[model samples]
Target: MLEILYYLQGHQSVYVGIVGAGIGALAAAIALRRARVAVTVLEAAGELLEIGAEIQMTPNVSVLLQRWDVADVIEDSLVQIEELNMRRKDGTLDGHTDIPVVEKALGRPWWLVHRAHLHEGIAVTAKRLGAAIHTNSRVVSLDHQAGGKVTFDLCRGADGLNSIVRSTLFPDVRPDAKTTNCAYRAVIPYERIRQDSIAKELIQKQTMEVWMGCNAYIITYPISAGELFNLVLSHHRPEKVYATQPDVPTEELRNEYKDFDPRIKCIVDMIHETSRWALLVTGPLKSWSSPQKNVVLMGDAAHSMVNHMAQGAATSMEDGAFLAKCIGAVVQGKLSLRKAITLYEVERMPKAFLKQQVSFLNGAIWRLAHGPKQQARDAAMAPDLEREYHVRSSNIYGDPQTVVDVYGYDVKVHAEEALEHFTNAEKDEYLGTGIVPGLEKYMGWFMKLPANQPHSKL
Candidate 1:
């Protein structure tokens, strides 16, 4: 018997409790509360900072965010770059995909939006919807109990990567990070990269372009409206990722990409300055929710894959929406937290795991580094990847149904389906409860391991 107010103190929500305040946080609060559940938000930092530049939102994520009514928040901050330029060594197009047609066919738009705006929008919306957002209030500790009573303290991992919450929940997975290469992340004024027609079209509208070269990969698109363009320029090297930020110099930015195309090189040269980090990633956490329905990891804390795929934030947000839908359905008597999270993992993990593979392929395409064997393999893959871009983009990529496969179904519809299974799955869930970790038991083999790794020096 916990006192509701005391429980409410330093916390909110009766159903989805003490969750990280990001996509998952908002989804839990908004979705659960909508179904008459109490939820609270806990953020280590106070106030949101829009740090990264343009992010690509695939149709699946957009489908969820639109239902959340926060799409406009991102829509305003985005420049929809529709064209994807696959520049050859000579800087000519190798192939192109029509963004408008893709969007029309998918029944959802592929968008490029500012990472910061999207963060703030979710933060603001969560607060408005009655989720307590503690900014600057770092989570100092976390303890997941056997009885499902998970607890934690704040003011830890507030400086970003050195997260206390991460250290607590995933001690084995905590970062003793290694730096492979350095990337300069910046959002230059539109005036810098907008001179050319292709670049100008990116600034003025929606288009996606990848500037590939022998030793580096620089991808840029519009975000924060046409006024700002986010650019990421990566150069590979052997260096140590300190337990702390290294004393990186601005000259390092210019020095790194000196050999790139004049346009991309200039974008780096004119960066005004740059921000850098040793890219870090962790293996998947297996599952997101804890047994008591009280705690879960979200956003970067859950999984931080390479930027090669361009779906990092989109994937995190999708997790948030799906998790939200899960908690909400359970509160509405449509399912249970255990079953809901199981279903959530069942649906979302496959997509992310697949994206990681596609991203590996895309990275190889950029470095022109796919080895001889892989070159032959890729020669075989071109038609399939292109076919995927053309045919599978509209429906979910897998499952039996053609009208809507597993991947493309609306999150709402999926939530309802999950609920149906939940009611019917009770005996199975009860019987299998000891046999597995809920719905995730069925997804054991769904995550296909990456077949190849990418290296710039290859």
Candidate 2:
């Protein structure tokens, strides 16, 4: 196996083993296959969640989805929102961005999908592409053997989130979820909400209507062939609690967002049940790879975030795609795994960490009162948030230039370049490596993508 690593460094023959089947694993399988690397995927869920909830796929995501031929698959089943309406705590229009038009301006479509459907779509595409998904199987512990092989402890922690894989890769960085508490999510039947003039108006409002209030926020959008509505509400409590087992009842759900507008009320009232879970954020780690094994952390296990900025799912998808490429390169003998992993961390850590922090702050601001900070946020996002009816629609489009730089990046570009750079060490494994890829030929893409150089600790 060690000889395989050396041969892999100079030749092209590598096989990849993945630990999870979420966005990261899916993307990894795609990328690895595209790069011609044999791959396998492992999952911890029984059946994929069929429950529906709205999800946003920014332009960065749109690019990859299109590239993978799954964009059409997802678009066929999701709603393309028209605009984004941001209102003050008192229900005054702060600013709005057009979603449908934004796609046109960016040359890509952004989609608002049912969460479960999106998962199914990805899993289906992955299966069709020959990627394996072993569910009802959990990875209990990781044994980093000497050869390029891994010993997984998959029998013990099989109940999903209490993942053995996560525990093994991040022993010292277990999630401290109590800080912010639960993020309340639910899908309301459209008929129940359409009865209200205001609610109906907002539903057909041709845009998203968001009401920011004291300690809570509610954003409404369409999903599930437009048969259902997607509602995401977040708030804070001194202690952590999940919505599925909330101390409060359905009646109390209305009181939580007490200050929201009437248009939002109809939808909230119609939410008979909510799928609530504790918001867990993992502490930063020194490495995403298990130095002692073949195990690697991906998705929420690596960078969990609140629902703010709607980047959690997107980020997870991006991780899967990038890992596939990285692992493919190593397995194919086109690059060294050690060198590839170094570039992976250098190029991925910064962006993922930023998204993590942004999700945290965005959620925090939403749960805050409608005073000074709200005023400041309204001023900052309004003008940049504005959208026209035809193009630059905030709902249907994204800042691709930004999303690509952050999420659309092809990690292989950097990995290869860093390896060839003269300053790159045979074993040093640092940014000093990026300099060797020859500035003229490959620097352009690196420069275009987000600058995810290593942190002092990463």
Candidate 3:
């Protein structure tokens, strides 16, 4: 492993063009720079601004960021949520889970953080690792061709939902994704909510609560070091909704959940400012990269899914990490860029598609109206208080193994396995062919080790 990294650093001039400065793109930049590859980040925005949104950082995401050494910056502003309480709209406690148990099992803490903090932390780390970030530099065109000798400047397409790179590759595929739901989001300062006797407990307890009900569900948690309360209310939108509308009136938002639990109703009423964001999802793309493999997609551009699983950001982070690892292999002359891109899609697309499907299903189950479906969902979610097992596995929340499968993915380990397998495959190919009669001249520089390269720390 150490030898491989030293070899990768020897080829540090492999230039990579990344099209976006979002979390996934920034992470990719950081990973590539740490591997000693030259990376440039291009952002469409003229200047980075606070997005003013909050996201959940599950154990999987937390662990990856930790491995990359940027976890401290994010951790400083995190609100550690210790439990998840699932309930029906009528305030019936359907089930609950100990977040600490899962955290202990996964070896990392789960947190809810403001998006601004996370973006800033990732940006700082990427710049520190020698990645050049250029804002207001949108990419409008890209072309690539593969031949006897593969040659093209590699470009990473993290340009987000309406990605032009994705459009260039799959022209028949539409950019506007289809969806049946939309969400209203807001953050209430603790100071404002703490004065209200009914809403004060929201600030007092460090727990994430999900209120599941007819045609809608609400999730709330403390963020910004418990300074504010973040709330997201998602509802089925039968009519076609626009991608996003920032000026939605709070009263209109509150009216959508007039029949929710009193607590939820109180939270809705307390929301003085909010915006509606469409939960659009593109089911699955036929391919995650171009035929040339020079341009590859990541994050929402690759797999945009509903947030019911809360794995949107986590999966995007994983994509960046895994893609970085593959690029590292390219840097070491162990894999061609085409092979690395193919391997990335082969391994990541399936998992991403599964998350998309499961998240859609979860949203369906959580937003059931008062009917047979709703009754069945509630009954299945009901807790078995008399069960002899000390550790609960089944409930309104997902099963324990499901939790592990979702939160326990280590991208670094998976990337290492892919590299090893690909390396072995190359050895087998070489053994089978003995030697390529005409390729020795081209392979000379690829096989030669640098004279004074040294292994670096992991």
Candidate 4:
């Protein structure tokens, strides 16, 4: 039986076992290797095929990608988002935000890339950095016994929503609960979109368009270097849990949005097929690390939230970066493994949970019913649209503070500051309670916003 390995000063390398080869896992592998730790990624799938279509890499994650030397690898594949249009169901523009201006303010570019491209880029980098990736190596059980030859000094779960590592670590925590929402995701070739005059007009500029309606919304953006147009249609669905249907009939999708704007309907009709996914969310766990401190969870395994905020993947990558930073400090003898794990959990868990709540709240705001509340939301956003840059707006994306909090985050600085605070504190106080006193003082600006308190219904 393979036992968990341990690191020694100037001796054996620390072995990190990562389950699931998604973006988070690959990212962690890359960061850990850069920290001089040995990494082995176990992917249950026979191949590393990323299932999703497009993902928005907000500046927060884009910066990390650049730091990991991943941006250049996928440079040609990234489409920079220039503008964002918020519209009503009838395609009437309610507001507009200059994405470039927001990007400028954040000091990084906002990127839209196909999931496959991003995954390939990260995987390539991880492999080049000497991280071993083994597909078809499903981990059915974890042996914590420490007698035999050790294999991994640490284990991280980036296995996504149905993470086996999460289940093994926190069996009593309820599994992910299916939200009353579902999304149909599809991508149409730009060539195909250009054939439709109306659709072609919509894609003439590299912009992301969001059409909001009663209890539903549609988002479209050009991705894959403007070669393809990605569409995400989120709507209320009966409460039910089911497997994702990849080959969802296009007709069914068109029928669902038949009442939308002509341009939207035109684009929907062009989709030959799509995939339906049930939006699921995991409630906050008290701790992301196991009691042994050897096994830990990150990414979707720890805090799976709705995709409304488009931060799921971005935040997952942040987890990888921050976790690697903590572990790096341990390898450097600046901190112990126990303190590193504690700092990782304490510093990351609240922020991730807050993101989960905010994502749900953003969805609620976007899908407000056609009533006074919806009108108020649009009315509140109108003034910000008239300005060159947003100060604050009802639209979460346009809200200046929200934009900064989500996009301006720097994981390296955050980890360094957190490490400093942990190091300065009485070690016994933190290690005994697993709490970093006064850590909330360093929370992102959005943590104090009223919007952070999601509706009770959520």
TM-score for all models, in order of appearance? 0.73, 0.79, 0.85, 0.90
Candidates ranked by TM-score: 4, 3, 2, 1
Off by over 4 Å in 2: 1-11, 44-52, 146-161, 242-248, 381-429, 432-458
User: What is the total number of backbone clashes in candidate 4?
Assistant: 1
lDDT of 4: 0.77
Q: Of the candidates numbered 1 and 2, which has the greater TM-score value?
A: 2
Across 1-458, the per-residue lDDT of candidate 4 in tens digits comes to 01122555454346677767888778888888898877778787899988789999988899988888899899999999778999988898877888888888788888999999999999999999999888897767765436445555456667777777777788776545456688998888989878888867887788999999888889999889999889999986667545576888777888778888999889889888778887778768888877878777888878888898898988888888888888788777788776787888888887787678778877877888886667666665676456634355666776766776667778888888888888988866553222222322222222334442321111
What overall lDDT goes with each candidate model?
Answer: 0.51, 0.57, 0.70, 0.77
lDDT computed for candidate 1: 0.51
For candidate 1, write residues 304-376 as lDDT tens digits: 6666656666666565555666656654555544565567656665555554444444454466543453333
Error of 1 at 436 (Å): 19
Clashing pairs in 4: 5-152
- lDDT of candidate 2 over 1-458, digit per residue (tens): 00011123344666555555555456656665676655566555685543436787776576777788776677667677777777754577865666655566557776777767777777777777776666666554544443335323111111124445556656666666746546677887778777767777766654666777777777777787787777877776777753245445777677787667766776788777665567776646576666632445556666676667778777766665655565565665555555565555665666677676656655555555655554444443444443322211121113333344443444445445544562344455454332122212211222232233211111
lDDT of 3: 0.70
Candidate 1: RMSD over Cα atoms? 7.6
Model 1: what TM-score? 0.73
Scored against the true structure, residue 303 in model 2 reaches a CA lDDT of 65
